[model samples]
Target: MMDFDVELIRRYAAENKIKFGRASSKAVIGKVIASMPEYKTRVRELIPVIERVVEEINSMSIEDLKRYYSPPVKKKVKEEFRLPPLPKAVEGMVSTRFAPNPDFVLHLGSLRPLILSYEYAKMYNGKFYIRFEDTDPKTKRPEPRFYEAIKRDVEWLGIKPDKYIYQSDRLELYYDVARTLIDRGYAYVCLCERDVFKKYVYNGLACPHRGQSIEDNHELFDKMLNRFFNEGEAVLRIKTDLNHPNPSVRDWPALRIIDTETYRHPRVYDEYIVWPLYNFSCAIDDYMMGITHVLRGAEHRVNEVKQSYIFRYMGWDPPEYIHHGRVAIPEGVLSKSKILKGIREGLYTGIDDPRLATLPALRRRGFHPKALYNVILKTGLSSSNTTIDFSMLAAENRKVIDREANRYYGVRNPKTVYIYLMDDVEVKIRVHPDHPERGYRIFRLYRGENYIYIDFEDEKYLEYGDLIMLISLGNFRVGEETLEFINNDV
Candidate 1:
């Protein structure tokens, strides 16, 4: 059933709920007959049981009637939730990607875009890619280990991307694009200091570097590639309207030199000193990689405006963009800086610590991928910030585990009891109450093998004439001392 149908069904399925204008089940049958009407997912099977319950109630003794009818537990259907269609999508040709920095393991917030991108790609029979945006080594540094860790986390979630890439490896491509723009006078090498250019751009005035000849700009840009310019000595700027409202967008920095001798890239080492910024590399890669659509958080909406200038200057058709609001888990340590610090200070064991909201942490806790699908699709493609709790996911997780996980019994604060069977008999136990088709686990109870364990907490009512069920094994009545085997009804 759809999400809207779930609440109505829940109220109808409540204990002693009326089905018609009044009660539907007969006086003797009670609410059990009405129970079948509330379960639309299992209506085919429940309908037959309703008729059988009505037929058998007349002959059933009052004692048996009390045992026969109890409300069935309402369950979340295993079926996946529905999501809205992608805007302006072209089936079989549409492509999407989840581009993440490999600085740390992905957290729950990352799933919002990652799942949406992957599902949309699968929905359109198109390609999904994972591009590591690992260009900034000074501040948001990338580590080699997290490269594989991120991929492993994605695999654990059953996502297989069609392609993978790293922006750090494409420095030459960014350099080549920068050269083309400089030669065409769409971009120029700025010699002005950082504060100097900010004042010029924001004041609706062009810096001296902005009005340089095409040859001079090309010469300086080639010098930048050849390491002739020191860090912060020069930068390539994409020319935009100085009078634009967002001054940072006007003449945005496309590429800049980093002092690799002090702050080195993990992969490239000190080989390259210059790197493309987020807007530049992203737009260029989106164009080169034929990324048809971009699904990212709404915080990047301004970045889209910045990137559009590069695409416009290059006469390239930019990818379609969809921005969503942030996804937050309040109890989670989502900030990468905080997480890294926690690990360094030994506050957390690692990225997969049970306290974390990282994908690895969730996987380690036995969460099913269906749990994530249900939660994400319910919050699908919206611009509203969402706060999620772990229990919300665990509730959906139990639905799947309840049907599949095998039965195992464990008791804390144990109490031992000895019982001698009248004769050797086999005790049969179904693997799962809801799924008897999985078969049963059988063990023969020897006449002399009489010891069993129960929780000491259950010793509260240990008196003379009381019956207790050993789960699926059998029913036993308490005598003067030991629990006596009465019957195997349960």
Candidate 2:
């Protein structure tokens, strides 16, 4: 309508300026037209009128622009991460662990738990440990090299684990716990077909073999441990409510026979046949290792609930669980499967590819560890998921790198510029303008053939009579294939 307020466009553009560092006129016009209910149907004709008003807004003086719109000034505050308190007293006896599967190197997502565990341990003056959960040798198989690679990544993050434990090395301990559970009438050895069990579970009924006696279940469990039962023939299920609302929590499978002869583990190749599932093994370790606190993503709350059953069965109190929302980089690939596939298909150079969000990639791209720590600490344990832009991370990194990284000029598509001069001149340029104490790099321009190469990037923006100043050198005006010195004043 002719009475539509046009000042709304400038107001919206100023709000966007705080977010994107600059207001886009096109974006402002589109937003203004979309905001009007009557102009929705006449977008084609309204666009030109809205665009013309936006143009006028863009040409306003900076001071006048500020009068219309400006971002609020935020007072700086010291960053202090607020994590939930541990359930029990931490009298320097607290122990925490970072259990990572060594299938691939650590990434940004992995660092979330790692940093939380490590920092909490240090905060309480307690011990920190690193545990490698490499039980799944078939699907997400672990590699031996990744064991050391993960250790290196943890150390690079400035975390030093007091103890390192491998799940493969503790297979015997899990077997002992499995035997205890079977003999205590808490677990049963399942020999039913996969489809048959699924039907029973779907109907909220226990399988026929769930009624087996403790002695009979013990025999089947021993048979499983000794490899008498084939991989798909048997599994050990924890006795839980079949009619539970959550089907996944209904009689969850604790251990299954993995035919290591076919898919061998890198650490203990073909040595064990029976393998414990995630909840069972993780719960058992938490109890055995005296872990006081567990920090993980909210996605694993199901695991926490399942592990509670294990703790109840064993007559032990489970550790405190702290769950935070998941995080992702808006521009980088954080998925492990995608990262591996990209490297295999030549879509990425490796895990260290700048396009990926792995620790190695960020390290290669000149990101300081403290900068990443700052971002994560600021996020804290918020329940909402975070999808931060890559520019935000880069801005944080620039603050740290700016103080240390040396300056260097890279010429792109260079073109020769001849300066007709009578005498040679030596120009002294500081290595870093702000850091003059570092030293100077001297450049000598020849007397007879006074010529230098300028990047085409800078050349393309200049006109025949445009005056510019080269760093540490005097101002000069662009001439026909030559630079005419205008003034040598400092």
Candidate 3:
């Protein structure tokens, strides 16, 4: 391992016209001594390290040598990003929506899809909406409070959706689409047991009930809606290619009999028993709500396939699908199940635990909304996965908040040092270093006090007889016990 930066040697080799290592170590040392000021003191220690780097550079490829010499010229793109015009976008007619389950509060990672959808809508002077995917009331249930909490967070981020929808409230609409799908022979009610269905499906074969008459399936479906079928007793399956390579996609389930008595929904408690599944409710809503483009994570790519079948069965066109990669953070808890577990187990205070990356936590910690907005704009629509380093967010926050935040002097440990002065000292300190026109605060040091507090950490920089320059006040020397007033030099 080299003690010094390897780039230094490569750059030095390239700059000196000595790519083949014909130059001697002494020559490199002499050149460093001439160019660098501190080499005069550390020349003895850095000699051998520099010599080793020179030897290593001798065998580097010609292309690598040139790479160090001349880096690729980056195209001068405009810093203000006008994101590439979305495909199939219509002026004043584009529409986008962010469909999130109202289980957990919105977290930092949720900002991507929200920002993309909202910004794309605003870009075309179109409509943006938020659809609450609250259909899975038993497994991934929604809370009455979260429906409003989600809206509050979005509004806090300056996103005003054109509409807000709850899937549970639209059960009747989903039932209508299911009926249409059944009439077209694109869906069927399956009564086979879980294991029996898996056996038939895994073998690329249909169960006995898959070929039931359309009229018969309708009767069974009505029974399910009327609470006739118990949980797992029957499910509506959208008929797809049973021989398809993806086993999960083979005649996937659309709606199931959810026993609301056992696990009640917060919004529609025991109101609807047979509820639509994710793909079913989402597909129905997308086409019905006039969604022009669907911007979501790439993991939902298979859901598009299931939803497309429903749209086709109804003779409707599916919305444009844009699936980007997932966004992750180090040790972040984005899973609602894990977060809910933590809260129930008393490990976390709530969804707004300052330790977590929830929107409320970041807001309480004073992170500006534009900081999160800039982060999303920087990431854009890359298909590759994103792992955010929070320091980048902090840097962005500093940029957003630094201009308006007033300056203040804070010290951990204050050390009182005796000061001998004949008169009081008054100084005007700027409230903000960048904006002097804002105002100034008057600081007065009384002479009768005979002492001033210095930061404990700054004491290490003092010597027996060193002078400390107090800006706009004067210079004073550090005495054995007292601070010697040097001069009234501002």
Candidate 4:
């Protein structure tokens, strides 16, 4: 042990470049004295406790010897944690917009898609905007009350958009896009009447305007536009691939002039006669808003391809697309337009009628937002059409409401009961049996009381001198029965 301690101290001193004052032979004798069992035990156990004192005495300067013996202590500075970088395409984050035409109140079909789009945007941590696509003046009813009601219903369902956009504010932009397409020879003004246009358009057949140059077509377009504005005439059609298999693909109308007083720009009606179609407007808006993902109902699946063609023609990258299934109503439920007619004709109340699947009606019937979310989640994010049982939704609602709703007892029909208890005896009845923590309600019982209220059904089963139990109170004996009351005198 003595020899081992001396060797350890000598090695540490050498490694640390510490110079002992004594020569090697004298140092060995001094080390022998210092490494005795008693001395070794004292130093080994106590040195760690006095390390700071030893460091101070030694004045440990490693600057000169660092390279030779002592290595520098590498200081570890604390660093702030950072998340991994996002893709460049989404670094600024993508934006999604839910554009609902405010021509009528939003029904279950609309709400289903809105919820889906909103949730999908949130999942990707993107911004969501709500745009009122009130472009068609003919369809746009001049009613602020309907708009206010729709907004209120959306808010009640907890879906508030980060930004609100209106198509009516961007009519000029749509016109500009239409003009660009016409100048680029991708669109031409059609002289054909509505029926002729529909036959060629719906059948995917080529129109006579397909081979005409914009210079040649513009003259005819101007004549049509002038007559349409001043005399009321024809429309402009987009020149797409006529050979495309989908009937919706052939020479589709990009613009049309509608003579309606409902146009917000009635004064500018003469300045621009042509109006952009739904697909054109959608393509322009999506590109301008920098939307990366377009989530919509499957009914618009074919429209997605049409919009993609428009984007391709304009040299813009179309947004990523996902089309979900539409919510179908049962046969008896009227179409939205018919429902509006019914409301106007006093067939039903306003849009939130309980029989309808509007958000307000579901809320009024005590359905929780969680239950609605659950229904959507259970439905899954697929394009397959599914009809969910209404009773299934109702059962889910009852589970949530049952825990929080207060209980009360009311008899539909009643008869009088007379009770005779000892004078000043008290009876206590609890409002809820399983919930005793809610406390109890008291009833006073007086001796020879003439009459009290009981259910009429309770009287038919009771006989003379029969003891009947009150739900939460002691039993009483029935003494007699009259037309008005059951007399108990026990």
Instruction: List the pairs of residues colliding in candidate 3.
Output: none
lDDT of each: 0.78, 0.81, 0.81, 0.62
**Which residue runs does candidate 1 get wrong by more than 4 Å?**
1-78, 434-439
Candidate 4 TM-score, true structure as reference: 0.67
Q: How many clashing residue pairs appear in each of the predictions shown?
A: 0, 0, 0, 2
Give me the overall lDDT of model 1.
0.78
Q: Could you estimate the TM-score for every candidate?
A: 0.83, 0.79, 0.82, 0.67
The candidate with the higher lDDT, 2 or 4, is: 2
Tens-digit lDDT track for model 2 on 294-328? 98999999888888888998899888888889887
Please state the error at residue 63 of candidate 4 in Å.
91
Better of 2 and 4 by TM-score: 2
Any runs in candidate 2 off by more than 4 Å, and if so which?
1-91, 420-425, 446-449, 460-467, 477-488
Best by lDDT: 3
Assess the local accuracy of residue 160 in candidate 1 as a C-alpha lDDT between 0 and 100: 94
Question: For candidate 1, lDDT tens digit of each residue in 136-209?
Answer: 98878889889999998888778999989989889999988888888778999999999988888889999998
CA-RMSD of model 4: 28.0
Clash pairs, candidate 2, are: none
Sort the candidates on TM-score, descending order: 1, 3, 2, 4
Off by over 4 Å in 3: 1-79, 447-450, 487-490
Model 3 C-alpha RMSD to native: 10.2
User: Residue 177 error for model 2, in Å?
Assistant: 2.0
